[model samples]
Each structure stands twice: as structure tokens, then as C-alpha cells.
Target: MSTAYGLTAVSLVVAATVLIGMFGLRISRTTSDFYVASRTVSPLRNASAIGGEYLSAASFLGIAGLILAYGADMLWLPVGWTGGYLVLLVLVSAPLRRSGAYTLPDFAEARLESMTVRRVTSVLAVLIGWLYLMPQLQSAGLVLRTAAGTPVWVGTVLVAVVVTINVLSGGMRSITMVQAFQYWLKLTALAVPVLFLLIAWRQDAAPGLGGDAPPTFPERTTVSIGTDVTVRVPAPVTVEVRGRVDGAGRAGPLTLTAGEHTVARDTVVTFPAGAAVPHVADLPVRTDAEWLRPLAGREYPMYATYSLILATFLGTMGLPHVLVRFYTNPDGRAARRTTVLVLGLLGAFYLLPALYGALGRIYAPELLMTGRTDAVVLTLPGRLIGGTLGDLLGALVTAGAVAAFLSTSSGLAVSVAGVIAQDLMHGGVRSFRVATLLALLVPLGLALSVRALAVADVVGLAFALAASTFCPLLVLGIWWRRLTVAGALAGLIVGGGLAGTAVAWTIIGGPPGGLAGALLAQPAAWTVPAAFAVMIGVSLITPRSVPAGVARTMVRLHTPETLAVDRGTWHPKGA
Candidate 1:
């Protein structure tokens, strides 16, 4: 039965994508159409495409899972993710579009008037693009394996082939139509199940615990501290226990010693359930938790906050898939309008995932044991609804999950392919064809060899890379007239090197904790400012190195839309 449902959904999605691609193919005539839809996309349609492509596997699956594991604190992930668009809309959208570039590298070259900067930007774009694509492929493999008991790689290969064909055949134009359709398809896929599950939950009287008895604690619970010490509690307790120490760095079991005892490492204390529990809210503002609230935990420190901010803000602007959609607009004003529409569409879609997370906290707490809370959103349908309705809902979620993977992977592949063709092969039919194959193959190979990282973690790494590299280049090159080639290179080396190292550590060593962990997890706060500083300082020291056409470029970037032409001369207008 599961196989049947899976096959049916897959067939329908493929058929729809092919049909859409064929529609695009009939109208797509020139290289310009394939690359940027001849820069004619309307604001509304472009916005839908942006929303579709932007909500990758991480947004669809990872956010709910993180919320399930971390409670309300995880809400920041989605909030940060969506807030990124707001920052992009305000700071970079119009000016970036007005630059009249096909990709990030194009803008880097045009603005900086340096082939060196263009090459550097292109390399970073491919890196970020591939890094982002890893999670999407992994998610595809996971969905097929979980839903249909198929070999994991089946889904990955299927998607790679389909996306490659779509991109190779029609490029950005084909994907825009496909992604716009997918956005609605995904929303329906999720919304339908949610509505049905809500109905089922209500019809079943919305019982607390879903007819299961409350969990009972064991007669005795053991509390372990540091490396070795353990204490046995006679009953369940909510108490703060302090420890004491002796010399030689060896501590005995936790006990109240004579006069004054200090809390020691490896000490364990236990209390009964009736004991006083620490009330975090009532604590003084100077309490450790209060002091550390800005950081997610002691293990992460300031890195967590900075990482979130960087991922949310800089990451949005750096994303190649997201940026390419702007190229589809008729002009800078249309791009700005498209971004505004995306903000509304994304804001609406985000609300549902939060709802799912809240529902999972109640209906599927057991997900913690599996350590795969990412599946909570998928499993909730069956648990909340029952029998056939539950199965149907589950299938719908499976479809959405598949769509998330396909749409995101497709977009990233398109960006990577475009960059490769333009920078490496000099942008033509042959370059596009070869680049398409390389784009799909490289990421697919990486996805196959590596164990699947958490979706958000992988996506965050992509963001960190973008923040370290492109974010600085874009922001500074657009706003700062003093930006020099030397400075951009220096910043790219320092910021990009640091961010890239952190990503490597994350992938190989797993999530770093403590200060190093904080740095690895969220290098953005430091890296972003550092990149900007380096760019400015270096440019200041070498004023003569500034691009010769700086004034003209600046004029184009800030001029109003009324002065801009549809074909060649582009200019930004007042917000």
C-alpha cells in the first residue's frame, strides 16, 4: 500500500513537471530566455517562483524537527530564516537588480571591474551552491527510503536526472515555471493533510495523550555529573544540586561538608520530587541562565546568536538560487516588487510549520528517543488522524517533502550550472550543456559518499560560506565606492577561509561546542564585519586601485527606474 501511494505521487509530480517544462520549451527560443526568461517575468509570478525555490528541504522538514527537539527556542530558526528576506528586500534587492548582472560573479566583475574578483566570486558561488544542494539530495534519499522502502539513492538519482534535464533543456525560464507550480503544489500537499488531521483530531475529541497513559518514572533515578560521579534519588525531583571538591582534582560523592562547601566537578546531588525546583523566571537578572540567554546554551556561547543572525541576514543575499530569480524580472523595480511579494508569501507559509511544530510537541514527544525529530512533521498526520485518512495525510506530506527536495535541488543546480557555464566555459550552448552535467554529478557524488548531516546544519553551513564570501562582496561593492580588488581578495581569503574552515570542522568533527563550537556553528557575526573591514581598509590604503568606472557604476546602481532601459541601461529607483 505504501509503495502504491509513493509511486502514484512520484508519477504525478514527474508528469506535472514534464508538462510544465514542455510548455516552457515551446516558448523558450534564445539563450537569453533559457538563462533569465528574457528579463520579462512579472512581479507576482516571480515572487511565487522565489518562494518556491527558497523554501528548501531545510525549511520544509528541518525547522519542524528542530522545534521538536529544542522547544520554543527553536522558533528563532524560522523567524531568522524568514527575516532574512526582509533584510534582503531593504538593503540589496533593487540595487542588485539595477546592476544588470546574470549572476553574482557578473555583478562582482561589473562592479569591481576585476576578473580576479569575478573568478573568486564564481568559485564561492559554486561552493555555496553545492553545499546547499547536499541536504536537498539527502532529504530526497531519506523520503523515498522512509516512505516506500526503496534504496535511499533512488530518490537522489531520480531527482538529479529530472532536474538536470529540466535545467539543460530550458535553464532559468523552465525552472521558474516549474518552481512556481511547485510552490502551490507543496502548499496544497501540506495544507490538505493538516486540515484533514485537524478534523480527525477534533472528531476524536482531541484527547490529551491520545489514549496513552501518562509515563511513570522509575522508583529510583540516577543523576550523573561530569565524567563519573552518580547519585541515586529515591523519587522524582526538581532541585538544584551543588557539589564539593577535595585536593588532587578528585572529588567524592556530593555531600554537605562541615563549614562551607563549593560546587565541584564530577559531583552529584539528588532530591525527592517534593524538593524545591529552580524557577528560571524568578531568578535574578544576573543568574547564569539569564546571563546566557542571549546564547542558546553554555556550549554554544555568542556563536549561536551570531550564527543565527548571519544565516538569517547575510545568507539570504548570498544564496545563488535566490539571486537568480531576480534576473527574471523586467527591471530593478520589478525585482523589488517581487521580493516584497515573496516576503508575504514566505511569511504565510512559515506560520504552518510553526503550527506543526507546536502540534508535534503535544502529539509526538517520543520523537526525542529516535533523534530524528525531523520526521515529526511527516509522522504527525498518521498519529493525529487514523486509518485511511491518516495514510492519505501521510502520503500528502511525503509528496510535499519530495517537492521540497526537488524544487530546491533544481534551483541550486540551475545556479551552479549557470556560473560554471558563464565563468569557466564562457556562457553558450555547449557550456550550459557541460556545466549542467557537472553540476548534477558533483553534488550527487558528495551526497552519496557522505553520511547525511542534519538538514538545518548543512543548510546553515551553506549560509555561513555565503556570509563569509559573497555577502561582504555584494554589500560592500554595492554601497562602498572605495572597495578595491586587493581588499576584496583579502576579505575573501580571511572571511571565506575562516567560514570554510568552520564548515569543514562541522562536517567532519560534528557540531563544535564551547567557544570553538560557537565559532564553527556561527562564524558570521565575526566573519561578516571582518570581511567588510578588510575590504574598506585595504581599499583605503590603495585608493588608486579603485575601479576606473566606479562613478558610472554607482550612478547606475542608484538612479531611478524612470531613467533605466529594459534592455541595456539599468538603474535603481527610490524605495
Candidate 2:
């Protein structure tokens, strides 16, 4: 049960990543190298880097934990997270690169021709970047605390220092090599242990890995909403159960007829294992709702589904850290190819977490009692494969976990540095260094103060915010000639304000239940549409606010590659 191997593996991965980053530092000389690897990254290399940066703590750890805690209902977390990249591949990748902008704000200013819009977008970009970075830092803390017995803050500080050094020293150009290498490192770290664990499981005769206790009774272990307790029974059974009703206030015995049964509160029924349970024939049936139901009696409204879907789909396009990766590519074609490759890499990485979640259900059901199901993936590996092999497997998982935190934090710092350098420091070298430090500060502070936030929940808030504020800006700015500064500002203010307010509530107030809970948990449903509507509505009102070169910009954004490449006239706005 000692975690020495886990600690050693994590330390080794971190050291290796830093060493690779230092190698990039040796070759990177120009400002362009620091910012975008001088825009010369190949498709495969950039794709691996994207995969490395994209697989944050949430994807690496939180998804499996969510599934272990919530049952099949939580599969959407991984599905939505991975599917977001597909949206990126189809809708945003090529056009975004062809825009000749280094960052989201740059694209906004060039397309809208408005300094105000640019500044507003910059602020939102930083906010989104910081929000996303917080989880990575917090997860680092979790990994160290769980695996190495280190204090929670130790991991956060370690990651922040390492990532800051890499970003400040060599920027994207250097981090690119580090992330690309880390991607393969992470894959190996995960894949090797899993293969060994499966072999061990088979060799061990696949014992009943789960707890010896029988499953909980359906009638006694019912889901309670307010005063109502609902149980799903498929057959007839006799059991002893106690039910209570508000205002009725009395314990009673209930006998059920075979077909369907509804028991009032303060009623008790007892049935032994293997008894035939009566089916609830009259209750309205919902197959999808059943799949979506929370394990611990939690309920999310139907609208929440739309909110989550919108957040996942639109959020990827607007993410500042994700957007920055496109700039690392040499041209539009490379960007498109990178996005496609990202889909494959992400899809493969997601499969492991789902397997881990399933394994946790069978091997470590007690995780539910601990209320930290997120640790299930990390913990279950040790249980299934014991002794030296299990220890090694735990170590490998730890390395992947560390890689997740490092890759994401580095990308976020780069994005934050880019925005600060361009806007505040007038694109000067001194400004980039200052921005990098400042970028690390905001997330570090947040991570230290808010150590208890669930990784997936915090990440979801980031996605919702990104969808509301940045998604519309990127989509409309790239594709629409009619998009104006006024429209973009209106959309950002309305969309960003709503999403930001929701995040604030999530941080300060915490989720309660029902519709309010759904809104706070997933704000993208209303916020995204509200953003798009505001942009379109305001654009209609002040048509003249549209920039004069809108048509030309759209032509440049959408023109065939040969035409634009032949002109040799396309230069990044800032460059």
C-alpha cells in the first residue's frame, strides 16, 4: 500500500518534461520562437502536443471518478469532453488558423476592427484561461497528497514553478516539444499498467473483486425527493422497509399487491435476498432518465442536458489554451490536421477512464462511502494488481496524472502570457515575462484557496464560460461579414456576464438542487444562445458598425489555400 513507486514515477515524469523543455530552450532564439515556435510545427508533432495539453486532470482522473460515483449516468462527462474536439475539427480549426491571428483576442480585433472588442475579449480570455488552469493545479495537489503523502499545496507549488520556468524561458516553442513528448509518456504510463493489470486479473482467476456485502435493497434504498421516496422494482418481493411522509408522521406496515405498489410514508416492509419484488407498473417510465439518474438521489432537470451539450460543443472552439495550440502550426492545413489527430488521441485516452470506472465499481465500491470517487481510478489500480506489479501500475497512473497537470498548466500560462504581452506590454519581451508570472499567480491563488472544488465541476464551469463568451465571437468573427464591433461587444457583455456570474455563484454559493442547481452547474444552454442572439440583434440595429474590410477579411479567412498561399501577402495582424 506504500506509494513510493507512484511518487517516484510522478517525479520522473516531471523531471523528464522539464529536461525536454530545457532542450527546446537551447534552440529557441527569436521572439517568434518563444510565442509560436516560429509557426513551424508539423501536423503530427503539433497533434501530439495538442493531445498532451488537452488531457488535463479532469480527463485523466475526474472522468473516471465521476463515473464511479454516478454510475452510467456520468458517461456524458467523457463523451462530451471528447466530442468537443470533433466540433473543433469540423467548425473552427481551419478557418481559425487562416485568420492569421495568434490568439482569440487577435482574431476578434482583426475581424471586428474594434479595439474595445479586442480588450474585452482579452479580459475574457484571461478569465477563461485562469478558470481552466485552477483544476489542473488543484488536481496536482490531489495527486501528490494521495500518492506521495505530500501536502496538498506542495504539488500545486511544484507544478506552478516548473510550468512557469518552461513558459517564461522558452514559451510555446519550448513547451511544444515537452508536451509532445509527455503525450507519449502519458500513453505509455497508462497503457502498460493496464495491460499488466488485466493479465494479473486473469491469472488470479478473477475473484469477486467487489465487496462481499450484497447489493442494497431497492425498496429500502430508494431515491428521496423532498418527502417522496421512489424505488425501481422489476418483480414481486417481500421486504422490511420503513418509509416516512411529511405531516403524516407515523410508522406503518404496508403489504403490496403483485402488479404495482405505492407505499405511503412511515411504512415498513421486510424481504430477504432472492425474494420476488413487485414491479412499479404505474409509475411513468423513462429509459433515458433512468440512465441519466444520479446514484445518490440527485436530480438534474431536462434543460440541464441541453446546457451540458451546448457547453461541450461550443466550449472547445473558444478555449484560449486550446486556441493557442492552433497558432503553433505552420499553416491552416497543419492546424486542420492537428485537430483531426487530436480527435483520435483524445478518443483513445478517454477509453481508459471508462474502464477504470467500471473496475472501481467491481473492486472498490467503498469509494462511494468516502465521497471522493475521483480517487477511484488512482486507488483501484493498487487493489486489482497487488504487490510489486500493483505498485508499479499505481506509479504509472501517477505519472499520467502528473503529465495531465503539467501539460494543461503550461498551455494556460502560455495563453495568459500572450494576451498580457500583446495588450498590456505592447508585445514587448519584458511584458511577456510579467504576464507569465501574473498568469501563474491567479490560478495558484485560486487553487490554494479552493482546494475542495470537484475537478469536473470546476472544469464544467470553465466550459460554460468559454461557450458563452468566446464561442460566438470566434464563430461569427470568422464566418460572418456582417459581424460588427457593437454586436461582438454586446454578445460578450451579455454572454460573458451571465456565464461569469454563474461561475461566481458556483464558487461562492454552491449548487443546491432542481432548476437553479442545473443552471449553476451548466449555464451554457441559455448563455450560448443569449450570446448569439445579442450579437445578431445588435448587429441588425447598427449595420454601419460593421468594419469596411469585412468582405476582404472573410475572403481571406475562407479562400482556397493555393490562392492565399500564392499571394504571399497574408501576415498575422500583430506580426
RMSD per prediction, one decimal? 9.3, 8.2
* Model 1 lDDT per residue over 1-575, tens place: 25677677776777677677777887877667767787777788889899889888898888887665554455667777778888888878888888888788888887888889888888989999999998798778767765776777998888888888777766678888889888887788777877776676678676442222222211222332322221222223343344443332433334333232232444444533322221111111122223223344234544576567766777888899888888788777887888889888888778777667656655664343234557777878877776777777778888788778888888898889888888888677677789989988988998988766668778978887887778778888888898988988888888788888888887877754457776777777777787778877888898888888888888877777687433344321100
**Inter-residue clash pairs, candidate 1:** 236-273, 243-264, 512-517
lDDT of each: 0.72, 0.75
Model 2 TM-score, all chains together: 0.84
- TM-score per candidate: 0.82, 0.84
Model 2 agreement with the true structure over 3-69: per-residue lDDT tens digits = 6787788779878877878778788776677777877888889989988887888888888877655
The top-ranked prediction according to lDDT is 2
Off by over 4 Å in 1: 200-298, 564-575
